[model samples]
Target: MTTTTIERQRLSIQTNPVDAEFQQQLDQVFTEDACALLVELTREFRPRLQQLLAERQRKQARFDAGDLPDFLSETKAIRESDWQVAAIPADLQDRRLEITGPVDRKMVINALNADVKVFMADFEDAQSPTWQGVVEGQVNLRDANLGSISYTDPNSGKAYALKENPALLIARVRGLHLWEKHLQVDGEVIPGALMDFALYFIHNLAQRQKMSTGVYFYLPKLQSHQEAKWWDDVFRYTEQKFGVPVGTIRATVLIETLPAVFEMDEILYSLRDHIVALNCGRWDYIFSYIKTLKNHPDRVLPDRQVVTMDKPFLSAYSRLLIKTCHKRGALAMGGMAALIPAKDPEQNKAILAKVTADKELEASNGHDGTWIAHPGLAATAGAVLNKHLGDKPNQLQVLREQDAPVTAADLLAPCEGERTEAGMRTNIRVALQYLAAWISGKGCVPIYGLMEDAATAEISRASIWQWIQHGKKLSNGQLVTKQLFASMLDEEAEVVKGEVGSDAWASQNFERAKSLLLDITTADELVDFLTLPAYDLLP
Candidate 1:
C-alpha cells in the first residue's frame, strides 16, 4: 500500500510479487515458458481489445443520441444463411442443471460435487478479484482438474473433496472491461480475461485432454459479434500456441448485453468453430437494458424484483435466443435461478417452487438446460428439465421455428409493473450491502433469501439511475430526485445497519460502500460498472 511498495511492484511484473507464498506459487504457475506465452497473448490481443472497447463507447454514444439498437444490416446474410456451431463435447451435452459460484477451494469442491451437469467456477461476477484471490483461484482449479483438490475447514474441521462423477467444470473469466492489476506484461497490466483464459487453459489442458473433455469456458458481458470474434481469436490462438486442435477450446457465450441479443446469430457463427451454446444471462441483460437504453423514457424499467424473466421483453429475448441457438445446432442454455435455500421449511419450499417454475418455463420453451445458484435446488431443476429432455441429451431438436416470430419491438417492450417506495428502499439496501461485501473480498453473498452477485446489484443501481433520469414517480406519488434518493439512501443505510447490527457495521466496509453508492447513484452522468471504481480499493 505504500508508495515505495507500489513502485517496486510496478516495475517487477514478471519477477517478484509482494506476498512470499503468492510469489512462490506465481513462479510455478508462470514458469519461464508460460510467462512467454502470456506476454505474446497480451501484446497481440490487447490492441484489438482496446479498439473493441472504443467501438463500444461509440455505439453507446449513438444509443444515447436516441438511436436504438437493432439487428445489424451488415450481418443479414450471416443470420439468414444456413449455419451450425461445432459439435458439443460428450461432457457438455445434457447440461440439465449447472451450479455457479466463486472459485475458493471449498466452493469449488462443493459446486463440482453438486448434483448438476456443470459448475461454472466464476472469476467474473461471482468473485472479488483480489491479487491473492485470482491466483489462489488458479491454484484451486489446477488442483481440481488433476483430482488432487482437498480442503479441511479450519472452523468446522470438515473435509471436502470431489466425488465420483462430479459436474463438469467450466471457468467464467472476467469481463473484457477488467484488467489484472497485480501483474503487468511490459509496462501495462494485462487484460484479466486473457490472463484467466490462458492460465486456466494451459494449466488444465493436459488433464482435460486425458479425459477427452477439452477446455470449456463461459464468456461473459459481450455486446456484439465482433467481441465474440475477439474471444474466438483468443481460443484459436491459444489452441495453436498449446499445439492443440482449433476445437480444443470451447465456449458458451452469455448473451447478457442488449446489443448482444441482436447479434446472436452472428456471434454463434463467429465462434461456431469453438462455441457450443448461448446462455441467457438474465441479470446482466437487465442491467444492460437499463444502461443501454438509459436515455429512452419509453424503455425505463420497473423495480428490480418485478423485472422478472417473465416480462415481455425478457421473455422475448429468451425465446429468440432459444430459436437462434437451436437453429444453429447449439444448446440454448437458460439464465440463473439465484435463490438460496431459506432456513424455514415453508419458506424453503416456496423458494424451490419459484426455481421449479422458472426452469419449467425454460424447458417448455425448448431450452436444453438451466442455471441454479444453490446445490439444494438442483433436484428441482433436474426433475423439471428431465421431463422435457426425456432420453435426449439436449433440446436442440425442439427448434422453435414454429413459434410466433419475435421482432425488435417485442425485445424492447416496456417492462410492466408498479414502482414503489418499498422497492426503492430494497434497491438501496441490496446495492449498499452488496457493495460492502464486494469491497470486503466477496462478490457473491446471500441477502434476503436471494443469492446476490454483481449483476443483481447492477440492475438495482441502473434501474434507480434510469428512474431518476426520467423523473419517475413511485406508486406512493413521490417524485424521484437527487435529494429524494440521497434522503432514502441515508435512511436505508441506517436500516441496513439495524438489520446487520452496529458492531458488524462498524467492522465491515459499509461506510465506504455507502459513500460509493451515494456517489454513483446521484452522479450527473451514469457511471458504467461499479466494479471499475471498486477495483481501485482492492488490496
Candidate 2:
C-alpha cells in the first residue's frame, strides 16, 4: 500500500494572461539586445505604468468632485477693469533687472522678494513635463501662495520676508504639448483642468478686489505673426468667457522663430493691444538657426565658447531688433543672460561684469530691459539698472520724438553714396553673406577671427533681406524679377567664389573678409549698400 503511493506534483498556475501573452510576444519579437529591455518592460514598466494609471484615476476623481478651485471663477474675480492694457510705468519698464525663477513656486516667491521689475516663473524650458509636477505647479501658481519661506541672501546670510506683488509675478505656462498632457487622463485629453487653471488665474488676477495689476504671461515659441494672433484670440476668448475685461490678459511673446524675425512689426501689431513687450530668446533662436540651416553643409554652429555678441552678424541683428522695437513704441527687451553660474562665485562675478556691460550696451541701444535666469543674477541686474537709471533718460524725449515709421519701402533704404567702390563692395559682401546664410537657413554665422560665436545668422539674414526686399520695391516701384536677380547672384557668386566651402582656408578667409567688411563699413554706408538697387537696374 505504501509502495503504491506516489508523490503528487505541485502545480504552478500563471494567473496573468496579459503577462504571458506579453512574454510570448517578447520572446517572438525581441532580439538578444532587446531582451533586457523586454524584461524591464514586463518587470519594471508594467507595475510603474499601473501605479501611474491608478494615481491618474485618483487625480481625476478629485477633479470630478470639484475639489480644485474653479479657474474661470477665480479669473472673473480678478478682471474687472481696463487693467490689462494699462501702460506699464516707465519706472517699471525702465527697471532693467530681470530675475528668472527656477520654478513657478520659486519664481513667484522670488518675484515677491526681489527688487527686480520682471520675475518670470518658467514652465517652458525650465520645467520637467511630469503630470503631477505640472498639476502641482499650476495649483501653486493659481493659489499664488508660497508658504512662509524666508527669502535670504545665500552669500551674506541676510533674510527678508517676501510680500506678494501681483504685478511682478509673471507666470510662464507650459507650451501646447505640456498643456495638452496636463489635461489628459488615461489617454483622453480633457482641457477642463488646464483651461480652468489658466482662466481662473488670469481672469481673477485681472479682476481682483484691489484690482492688483493684471498678471502677465511670458509667451514662448511664437513662430509667426499668426501664432501671436492665435494667442491673442485665446486670451480674448478666455477673458470674454469668464466675463473678464476684453483685454485683461497681457503677454510678452518670445521671438524665437525665423519667420518671427521678419514679422516682428506684424506680430507686434497683431498683439498690439495685449502684448507688454517682446523678448529675444537667444538659445532657442540659435536652435532655430541650426534647424533652418540644416541643409547648408558649410555652416555649423560655432563652439559655444567662441560665440560672443561682437560678431558682425550678431551685433548687426541685435542692433536691428532694438531699433525695430523702439520704432514700434514697444519695449525692446534684451535676450536672456542665462549663462550665469549659480554655484561658482568667481564665474558669477565675471558673468555679472559681462551682464553689466551688456545691459549698458542694450540700454544705450534702446532695449528697455534684459533677462536674468537666476536669483543670484539679481544683483547683476540691480547694479546695471542702478548705473543706467541713475540719470534716467527724459521720458519727454522718449515720448516727444516719434519713432520714424518703418514701411516696406523703408526696408529698402539704400546706403548713401559717400564712399569708395571698395567700401560699397564690402557692404555688399556683408549683405550677401547674410542673404546666403538666410537662404541656407542659418540665422547667424560666425566671422572667423573676430567674434567668437555671437551673431545670429537668422537676424542678419532677415535684416538684410528686409532691406533688400523693400529696397527693390522702392527702387523700381515694383517687385524685381527673380530671373534678373538670379543673373546678378550668379555674377556675385563667382566674385565671391569658394565662399561657401567647408575647407578651413575657405571658411576662415570668408569669415575674416566678412568681419573686415563689417568693421570698415559705416552705418550710413551699410544702409546705402543694403538699399542700393540691383547693379544692373537703375533707380
Candidate 3:
C-alpha cells in the first residue's frame, strides 16, 4: 500500500534473480501493484504463522510426555452443536475422481485434460521449492487458467495442448511449516504458504468468478483447528481487500496430521464459512502417527505396504472422517490410489483391480469421492464411485449412523504385521531415489512403477529413524542398529547409482540427495523435517 511499492513493481523476493524471459512470466502474474499488495499481506500474516508454528512444537513436546491429543474442550460446543458449512457450489459437488501433479506447464496441461473430474495443481509436496520452480509454477497456473497453456517437447517434437473440456482446477499451496526465502518483508522471509496462496488467489479469483467456477484450494498439513482458524482469517482478509463476496473461496483440508484427526469437527467449524470437504491424506497421516508417538515402542508401525486402509488404525480414521463430514453436510474424499498402471498386461490388470477395490470401499462407506495420482487409473476409481453414486452428485445424504464409534485407542491401534530387513531396505532405496529427484527439481517421481511425492519420502525417512530409535527387530531377529543401517544405505546408494546410470548419477543431484538422507536419518536427534535442510541445498 506504499507509494514506492506501487510506483516500482519489481523488488527483491528471490536470492537468485530470473532472466528477462522468466521475469516476463513473473511480471505477467505479479504486476507492480499486485506485488505491493502481496508484500503487505505477507507482513500481516507472517507473524501469525510463526506463533502457530511455535505452538506446534509445544504440542509435540507434550506428546513426548505421553499425552495424547483429544477433542478440544474449548470447542466442544462447536462439535456437538447442529450446524453445517456453507452450501457447496455445483462444480465442486461431484468430485468423483481427481488427478494430482506438479505445476509444470506440460504436466498442468495434461492433468487438466485428464479424464478426472478435478485436477489438484500441486505446489507443495509435488514441487522442488526452488526460486525458478516456484515462480514458473505460478506462471504455468496463470496461463492454464486462461486456457492458453501449451508445450512442445524439444526432444520428441510432441505438442501438448488443453482439451476442449478440461477438469476443474484446484491449487494446493505450501504448508504452514515452510518459508519462501526469496521474498523478504523487513528482512524476514515470507511463509511459502502465503506466497503460493496469495499469488494464485489474487491472479485467478476474478477469472474464476466470471466463469462461475469457485476458486478452490487443498489446505495441507493442518495440525489443529487453531491453524485452520488462521487460514480462515486469511481468506476473510483477502476477500475484504478485493471486495470479493464471502464464501466465494472454498478449501478442502487434508487431515494429514495426528492432532488434526482428533479435531476434525473443530477444524470444520473454524473454516465453516469456506469449508467444502475433508480429504484423507493417508501417507502423511501415517508419517505423523509415527512421529507423534515416536517414544512408544508398541506404536511403531510395520512395513509401509502393510499399513493399508483395511488396517485397524487407518480404517477407524477414514470411517470417522466419513461420519464427521456427512453429519455436517460436507463431502468426504478418500485417499489417493498411488499405484500407476504397468506395461505388462497381468501387472496392469492387478493394479486396476486394486484401485477398484479401494474406491469401492470408500463409496460403500459413504465417501463422496476419491483421488488418483495417474490418469490411467481414473476410470477404474471413477467407475466404482459412479456405480455407488448413480444419478447423484455426492453421498452426503447417505448417513452411516450405524458405524461403530471411534475411540482414541482405536485411532492409535498398533501395527500387527512383521518388520523385516526387506522393509528397511525398501525405505532407504525410496528415500534416496525420491530425494535425488526432488533435489533435481522434480518433486513427483515414479519409482518401481508407483508415483512418489514428498509425503512418501517423509514417511520413508521417518520410518527409518523410528525403527532405529526403538531398536526394532526384524522378522529374522536382526536389530536395526545404526551400523547395520549405514552399511545398507551405502549398498542402496550404489544400487540407485547403477539403476540411474553413471551419467545421471553424476549430474542429477544424487550427491546432495544422498548427503541429506544420511544426515536426516542418522542424526542423534530427529530433524524436524527433511525439507527444511533440503531447501537450503537449492540454488
lDDT by candidate, in order shown: 0.90, 0.46, 0.88
The superposed Cα distance between candidate 3 and the true structure at residue 486, in angstroms, equals 0.6
Per-residue accuracy of model 3 over 394-449 as CA lDDT, tens digit each: 99987778977898889998978988888888999999999988888898999987
Question: TM-score for all predictions?
Answer: 0.97, 0.53, 0.97
Question: Residue 288: error of model 1 in Å?
Answer: 0.3
Those runs of model 1 whose alpha carbons end farther than 4 Å from true positions after fitting are 2-19
Q: What TM-score number comes out for model 1?
A: 0.97
Assess the local accuracy of residue 125 in candidate 2 as a C-alpha lDDT between 0 and 100. 53
Ranking by lDDT: 1, 3, 2
RMSD of candidate 2 to true structure, Å: 19.6
User: Cα RMSD to native, each candidate?
Assistant: 2.0, 19.6, 2.7
Worst 10 residues of 3 by lDDT: 1-10
Cα lDDT of model 1 overall? Answer: 0.90
Report the lDDT tens digits of candidate 1 across residue range 1-539. Answer: 34212222222353223677876776667766566677888889999999999999999999999998899999899998997898887888889889999999999999999999899999999999987788889999999999999999999999999899888899999999999876676678889999899889888999998987899999999998999999999988888877888899999999999999999999999999999999999999999999999999998888889888789999999999999998999999999999988889999899889988988899999899999999988888899999998999998888786889889889989888988999999999999999999999999999988899999999898888888999999999999998899999999999999999999898889999999999998887899999999998888
